[model samples]
Target: MDPGEPDPEPGRIEVLRRRLAQRHGERLFAEGALGPRRDLAGVLAYVLALLVHGVTVALVVAGLLLVVLGWGQGALPVIGGLLLGFAVVLRPRFGRLPDDTPVLRRAEAPQLFALIDEVAAVAGTTGVDAVVVAADANASVTTYGIRQRRMLHIGLGYWEILTPQQRIALLGHELGHFANGDTRRTAVIWNALHSLALWHYFLAPVPEPDLVERITNWVMTPPRWAVYGLLHLLDQLTLRSTQRAEYLADEASARVGSTDAAAELMDRMLVLDSVEVALQRESVIAQTKGGAGTRRETEQGLWERLAARVESVSEREYERLRRVSVLRGHSADATHPPTHLRRRRVSEGEQWQAAVRYDEERAHAIAAELAAARDRVARVVISDTAC
Candidate 1:
């Protein structure tokens, strides 16, 4: 399947969910919980603050102009306030206090750096300068490369939702992004040309619902249509860049983790989309994939395969991620990319068990060690007499 293209597999999700539920609990997505990143939160605050301030200032300017037309200064305040509210619905505000969550790198957890280093080794890439877990569940590998800035940001949502193995799988994907250098900042030049064309050509809002007013409106709204049209056009032109990048990332994931690990993650996301679509289907938007049961399970995995493929993460880790993978909510409000989608694309599915060479002995060792670590963390949390 082309990367990013939708090819919903049949019966795969239900089975995966069952498999995960049996091993781990369901993924929990509590409302108002931290799933979006803090940068977005800060970005929104700063950006919207500027937009609002701009609109407020603009309204003051507009109102003063109105005063020259004989509208009293007394009426200006009310007019300015209403204009500010109206501006809220204008072009997508890049600033909104993203969901609140603490930074992971700065968290009290001592194991973060070691975990990052371990991931870098597994991924065959140098470790990042720092690592952080955002309040959100999303994770990203961002870098433009060579003297350009490169950084990986993982949302707390993934940390919360994934088991250690899944987390390992996820980290592989992001590091792949860093390793692959997914930043398209270089595309800015082309994008600028596109925007210039849009500004001169189609950069006008729909002027006519019908007739002359629509034409007039289209002619009048330059900034709005310029921004909106450029965005729409980029989705079409840049999609190939995006798809290819995603494919590369998936390949990176396969190299770092077993192909099957990637496959399981994909299946996990397929289940998430299925469940979400199921809910939306019932919720009246009614957008759900029809036709279940007749589909064949061609993707990969059938229990034993999953065991060998997921060896990087302990069985315990799989159980933990599966338990939490039952994450819910739309990705609309998300600052982080959807794990369901990223993991699936990165799976690059091809039977991987043949190559995994599982160590049942090591699994046992890691399980015992991790169990002890959990107990120690619990003790630390509990012994804190200071609330």
Candidate 2:
């Protein structure tokens, strides 16, 4: 799988699946004991995903066969016909969801794209196909289209809040997701899991199942149970793997960016969530009270105020942060290693050349350049919230 080569087709999703498995194998060899058990877990997840799909198809086919066979038999024909009709209505549809995130063209933010390119080069990741600016306070790289072209999404909330150093570190971390093969791999697995969920949603017993509906439950409950069992198994295999992937991604960021920068970014993330919550509350209040100014201005004011809140975290807040166990790896329920662990990893690590410039002047310029896109995203946030 050459990084330079284009992905073949929408239908060749299975090839990507194979490539993901091979990538996992290469990772195992490259990482030795330090590698997460995720490759195997990924393999298992992909396999189980396929198995679930196959079993679903097979069961549908079997039900159809039962219907055809039952037609000749006495009472079984009626039962079979009913079951076949039930399956038809309850089948899950496989359609891709549209990308609602606001996309930023190179013309709109040439500087941001250039920055992304610089970060990607240092992080050893492939080129990005698109850049998305959204209203949230985080960043990620994802794949879309038949060719599985990669896109990077920057959350305006976080973008406005993070320092230049933190921004570079965050971008490096997101690009690292592509380098570690987590982006494309996770995309497939997520879709698989989603398909199962859709299946369960459609097939689960209805509110008022008549006798025929009861029969549908009798026939479908086993497969529904199977889906649940497989979902749980997939989670067990992949949860820790997800946590490890996060750690590896951070290390990748540290390699390209500074460890201290990355560590500080993680620490800031602990409080960013709180900041975002406050921003959301303020936005709603402004909207409700019909305060002066356009939604965009209110959004801007709320964002500025929220940034101020982040800048002035009280000693009590610091103490609360210190006491926070969830941010320190206390919960296995989370996908990422806790904030404390990530900060420690980066802070204690050897320093490296900064991948992108992090001076105050450049930071200010970047913020100015992104101001328009940020305002547009603010409108998006307000509109979404109002709905």
Candidate 3:
């Protein structure tokens, strides 16, 4: 669909979805509102963790500076250790899937039924409730309510690859989230708080009692590499959160289809005009060498790696993916796991696929509000066309 076209009612779209979701007498879900609260404890725990991580890291940095500067001898490592501890904890980013739009629609493909049926059996659930394609750039799969609105986002690059079977197989994994609603719902609060933590990310400074102001200032002064290191650490943590989510999705996919399918899909998507993965890496390797011969060699290595990862898919397909950002400039900070990592874990069969129970109180309560975001997704992309 041209992102410019106005969408039909999501509730109406839900009707088309019902046909796709309920093939085979499957217990299809249709809810979109937010679930009830259960992640409170999980969120609280993480908050406590951040507090602890921050305080401890500050102390350790202080201790290290004291010793290195000879302000104190034995206490330096101890203090540094405290600061490092907090740094380690606070530095790692975590969050739940942000509340976003999820569009539910039917498979125009007649063959979609078999794939749905197969996954339904694996998921031990009826219908997937919806087949979601992210209206935007991010790639994610999230389920809300009893049959869940199974939202699966693909980068424009990813949609370019794949036979119909591949798409259905990918969708099957989203169905896994519905079946594994148990696990997903359980993680919701952990996710919500994590999401909140990220949404409100800041270096607002340590509380007075644990201030690392003096040391933090010194370390960050003089164009400190430590500041850069800390930023990298945060990015790494964010990447990990996304990676974990992919692990969960891969595991879900493998349970219904072959690990190879999931792995291939992920690998293909990673390099497909992923400026972060493909262009950015190429640029970095080139700069690292800074000589014509060396630059060529570095780019060649990156090219070969990217080419091998997507050998099954054609360059023309990726070229199509490049179209996604043709009107835009390079983006920074990819929110998904690296394609290579996603491929490896899926191929190996991750632990995240197993069935877990959804917390009804939490999931059900959130369903109504959740649907609002779905409605927005069904509507907003029309305007983004201009953007």
Candidate 4:
């Protein structure tokens, strides 16, 4: 490297980061071996996360001490107050579920809830408190509020395309997050990371539209970069553990949904782009219909049509997608390990027979329960596409 050469762009740096993370992950989980041990790197990451939270607590304590000791001093009281206010403003938050999310209660979707419960039990986790449907081609399990009530978010765009067994695999994988030793998901670590992220966001420089704003940004730049570096360090420390959690989640998926089904789910993930395209096409077609009544009628069968389109995806196309995934080192996201690695790992282990099973009758009953959510999601998709 030349001394005078500029540093890589942020996008290039991120790509390099991901590549390094992936290499570390591949080395950690060689040949799909699942050992019951935490590596030194994972332990260090966990300790660092704890230390971050401890620092926050220390800050609060120091602020209080300053307020008490400097009761009569003008400058000291103001400094103490500023510190207290900063702590309050940057406090860790338990995020709320979006109001627009189409949530399904157990009472309204007993059959669906039952299936999820069975999958949860098989995956060694408890049943979710609520199930929400969305329009993206993804699914996840998360906790909400101080109570940490569990919630499952299923993307209709993805769910509508999967086989019944694949759906069970998806549920098992998500519920597995609870059982997996995913340090990042733990309250202490998650909140610490969240607070740091918030600090980074607040400290970041905005567009300098005026001299005063420019000065403020210039003053803020050093602290912003400091926070950015810290965040990246923490992320690097936890990268391997996070990736390991994903593989463990895949194992859970296989345990409850069978290895074949779980592997098929990975293949499905590889072609999610095609799924998105089909969904957009459907949305556009619905919008093109002459009247609101016609569009609504089309929306009602949207899921069925989408399902058929996905089902119609040929083996040749699937193979092509798999090859593409391999070539591109495709992953669900930067946080996840590569798709091909996950797929290979799940299949390499002793083929897991499903502990839980799904039948057409049960599948139908679950779909019946999700009917309202499907319609609502369809409407949302169409509305967004029209706009």
At residue 339, give the lDDT of candidate 3. Answer: 39
Tens-place lDDT per residue, model 2, 106-222, is: 677667777888888888876686787777777777777666777887876776677677788888998887776552246556666666666667668877889998998889988
- Residue 18, model 2: lDDT of 36
What C-alpha lDDT values do all the predictions have?
A: 0.41, 0.65, 0.42, 0.81
Candidate 1 lDDT tens digits, 1-387: 112343344353233323332221112111112132222333333343344345435655665555565455577656755555543433222212223322223133335545555666666676664343342324665433344444556543233334445555666667755554322323332333333333434444463367776877766686665454443443333323333344455555565556766656544443333333322223222112222221112111111222333334555654454444435311211122234444444443443432222245544544443343333322322222220
Among the numbered candidates, top lDDT falls to 4
Give per-residue CA lDDT, model 3, range 189-274, as digits (tens). 33433433432343323345345676664544544443333333333223333333434555666665555555555545535444
What C-alpha lDDT does candidate 2 achieve relative to the native structure? 0.65
TM-score: the better of candidates 3 and 4: 4
Candidate with best TM-score: 4
**In model 3, which regions exceed 4 Å deviation?**
1-102, 105-114, 123-126, 134-139, 144-157, 179-248, 274-338, 345-387
For residues 1-387, could you state the per-residue lDDT of candidate 4 as single tens digits?
112234334463367567766885687668456554466766776787777777677768878988999888878877888778878866767766778969887899999999989998988878988888998889998888899898899998888889988998999999998888886776766777777777778887777458888889999999888777767777777776778889999999999999999999998897687678877876777777757886788777777887888888888877887777767667887678888888888888769988888898997898788888888888888766642
Minimal lDDT window, size 10, model 1: 294-303
State how far residue 275 of model 4 sits from its true place (Å). 2.4
The residue ranges of model 2 lying beyond 4 angstroms of the native Cα positions read 1-33, 36-39, 55-101, 203-221, 291-297, 326-333, 351-353, 383-387
Better of 1 and 2 by lDDT: 2
